[model samples]
Target chain A: EAGVAQSPRYKIIEKRQSVAFWCNPISGHATLYWYQQILGQGPKLLIQFQNNGVVDDSQLPKDRFSAERLKGVDSTLKIQPAKLEDSAVYLCASSYLAGGPNEQYFGPGTRLTVT
Target chain B: GESVGLHLPTLSVQEGDNSIINCAYSNSASDYFIWYKQESGKGPQFIIDIRSNMDKRQGQRVTVLLNKTVKHLSLQIAATQPGDSAVYFCAENPHDDKIIFGKGTRLHILP
Candidate 1:
C-alpha cells in the first residue's frame, strides 16, 4: 500500500510571506496529524484531525496558522505572515485509528525555510 | 503540559555491541510509549511500543522497557549494526490519544 503523501518537499520564503502545505493520508486511515520539527528538536504537534473534524489544535498559533481536512480526506496547513522562527520541517502522519497505540505512518515532510 | 525527554543526546557503539537509549516522561497518566527511528531527510518510523500495563516488550532485535514507578523508559538493541545509525525518538501518549515526542538520541555505529 502507498504511504502518506505530502507536497513541495522543500520551500523557501521570506518573513511576512504566506506558505501552505498539503498532505494526503494513507488509504483507510482515520486519523491525521500535522507537526512542526525545528532543527535539533523533535516534531511538535500543531493540529490533529479525525476524519474531517479537528481533534486537537491547542498548540497551533491561531493568529498565524490554520489547517483543515476537507471531506474527511486530504488536508492542508497554512502559515501566513511567516516568521523566521517558522523555518522548520512540517511533517504529516496518518494512523489506522483515532486512538490507541496504533502506529503512525509519516511522509517525507515539507522543509520550510523562512528568511 | 506533557513532555518526553531523553537521557542522552548521542550514543556511539561498535558493531556487534549492545546499545541502550534511555528516556523519561513527566506525565504519569501516559499509558503508551513508542520508539521511532529517523534517518537523514526521512521521517520517523516506528520501531516498537509498550503500554502501561506491561513492563517490557520485545520486537526483532529491539526491546523496550518501561518503568512507570520512576517514569523512565529505555530501548535496547542487540548486536547493533551499521544500519542502526540514526536518531531514535521516544514518544508518550498520556491518554493513548495524543502523542508527545522527546528530543531524540543520535546513535552512531562504528564498523
Candidate 2:
C-alpha cells in the first residue's frame, strides 16, 4: 500500500512571492488534510477536505492562503504573497472514511522557507 | 489556548532503556487520543493510540496510557533504540473528528 505523497520536498522563496505544494493521498481514503509545522512545534491543521468538500479551514489564512481538492484524489495548497512568518513544513495526510478513531498516514512534508 | 501540551520539552535516555513521554490535555470532551513520532525531516508517524474508554493499549514495542480523570496521557517505548530518536506528539479528538496536536517532546537516545 502506498502512503500519501508530496511534491517538492523543499522550497525557498522571497517574501511577497508565491508558493504552492501538492499532495496525493492514499487510494480509497476520503479524508485529506493539510497542516503547517513551524520549527519546534507540532503540526497545525490548516485545512481539511472530505471527498472534495471543505470540512474545516478555520485556521487557514484566507487573505494569503488557499487550497483546493478538485477531484478528491489530489490537493494543492497555495500561499500568495508569502511572508517570512509562513516559513514552515507543509504536511499532508489521509485516513479512511470511518467515523471512529481514524489513523492518519502522513506524507513527507514540503519545507518552505521565505526569505 | 493549547488543548494539549508535553510535560517535557526534551528528554535524553540511554539506549536499551525504556522511555516515557508525558502529555497533558485539557479537553474533557475528547474521546480519542493518539501518539506520533516524527524524525528531523519527515512528517509525524503514528505510534500508538488509546480511546477514552480504555486505560491502556499496547503495540509491538510501544504503549499508550490514557488517564481521563486527570486528562493525562503517556507513551512508553521499550528497549529504546537509536532509531527511536525523534519528536513525539500527542493529539486528541474531542468529537472523534477534528484533532488537535500538542507541542512535541524531543526524545534523544544516548548510545
Candidate 3:
C-alpha cells in the first residue's frame, strides 16, 4: 500500500514571503494531520482533519498559518508573511481509524527554509 | 507547551549492543503511547505503540514499556544496528484529544 505523500520535498522563501505545502493522504484513511518539526525537536501537530472537518487546530497560528483539507482527501498548509523562525520541516501524516485510533504514517516532509 | 520530555538528549551505543531510550509524560489522561524513529531529512516513522491498558508491547526487535503510575515510557532496541541510528520520539494521546510529543532522543551507533 502507498503511504502518505507530500509535495516539494524542499522549499526556500524569503522572510515575509508566502509558502505552501501540499499533502495527499493514504487511500481510505480517515484522519489526516499536519505537523511542524524544528531542528532538534519532535514534530508538533499544527492541525488535524477528520474527513474535511477540522478535529483540532489549537496550536495553529491563525495570524500567519492556514490549512485546508479540500474534499477530505488532499490537504494544503500555507504560511503567509513567513518569519525566520518558520524555517523547519513540514510533515504530513495519516491514519485509519479502524477498530480504534491506529498508528500514523508520515510523509517525507517539506523542508521550509526561510531566509 | 509540550509536557512530554526525554530523559536524555543523546545516547551512543556500540553496534550489536542493546539500547534503551526513556521518555516521561505528564498527562495522565493520555490513553495511547507511541514511539517513532526519524532519520535525517525525513519524517518520523512509526515504530511501535502501546495502549494504557497494556504495560508492554513488542514489535520485531523493539519493545515498548509503559508505566502508568509514574507516566514513564521506554523503548528497548536489541542488537542495535547502524540503521537504528536516528532520533527517537515518544508521543501520547487520548483519542481525539491533542497528541503531545516529547523533545526526542538522538541515538548514535558506534562502529
Candidate 4:
C-alpha cells in the first residue's frame, strides 16, 4: 500500500511572498491532516479534514494560512505574505478513519524556508 | 491550552541497552495515546499506541505504558540499536477529537 504523498520536498520563498504545498492522501483514507514542524519542536496540528469537510482548524492562523481538501482525496495548504517564522516543514498525513485510535501515515513533508 | 509534553529534550542510551522515554499530558479527556519515531528529514512514523483502558501495550520489542493517575506516558525500547536514534513524539487524542503532539524527545544511541 502506498503512503501519503506530498510535493516539492523543499521550498524557499522571500518574506511576504506566497507559497503553497500539495498533498495526496493514501487510497481509501477518510481523514487527512496538515501539520507544521518548527525547528527542534514537534509537529503542530494546523488543520484536519474528514472527507471534504473540515474537522478542526482552531490552531490555524486564518489571517495568513488556509487549506482545503477536494473530493476527499487531495489537499492543499497555502500561506500568503509568509513571515520568517513560517519557515518550517509542512507535513501531510492520512488515516483510514476519522477517530478512535487511528494510525496516521505521514508523508516526507515539504520543507519551506522563508527568507 | 492543554498540551502534551516530553519529560526530557534529549536522551543518550548505550547501544544494546534498554531505552525509556517519558511524556506528560495535561488533558485528562484524552483517551488514546500514540508514539511516533521521526528520523532526520522524515515525517513521524507510528511506533505503537495504547488506549486509556489499557495500562500497557507491547509490539515488536517496543512497549507503551499509560498511567492515567498521573497522566503520564512512556515508551520503552529493548536492545536499542543505532537505527533507533531519532526523535520520539507522544501524542494524545480525546475520543473523536483531534490528536495533539508533544514537543518530542531526541534519542541518541551511543556506542
- Candidate 1 lDDT, tens digit per residue, B12-71? 999999999999999998889999999988889999999999999999999999999999
Tell me the tens digit of each residue's lDDT in model 1 across A1-115: 9999999899999999999999999999989999999988899999999999999999999999999998888999999989999999999999989767688999999999998
lDDT of 1 at A54: 93
Question: Against the true two-chain complex, what DockQ does each candidate achieve?
Answer: 0.76, 0.75, 0.59, 0.72
lDDT (C-alpha) at residue B13 in model 4: 99
Residue pairs with backbone overlap in model 1: B30-B94
Pairs in steric clash, model 3: none
TM-score of chain B of each: 0.97, 0.97, 0.96, 0.97
Candidate number of the best DockQ: 1
lDDT (tens digit, per residue) of candidate 4 on B13-102: 999999999999999999999999999989999999898999999999999999999999999999999999999999998768577899
Model 4, residue pairs in steric clash? none
Q: Model 2: how large is the Cα RMSD against the reference? A: 1.0
Local accuracy by lDDT, each model:
0.94, 0.93, 0.91, 0.94
Once superposed on the true structure, which residue ranges of model 1 sit more than 4 Å away at CA?
none
Return the DockQ of model 4: 0.72
lDDT of 4 by residue, A43-78 (tens): 998999999999889889999999998788999999
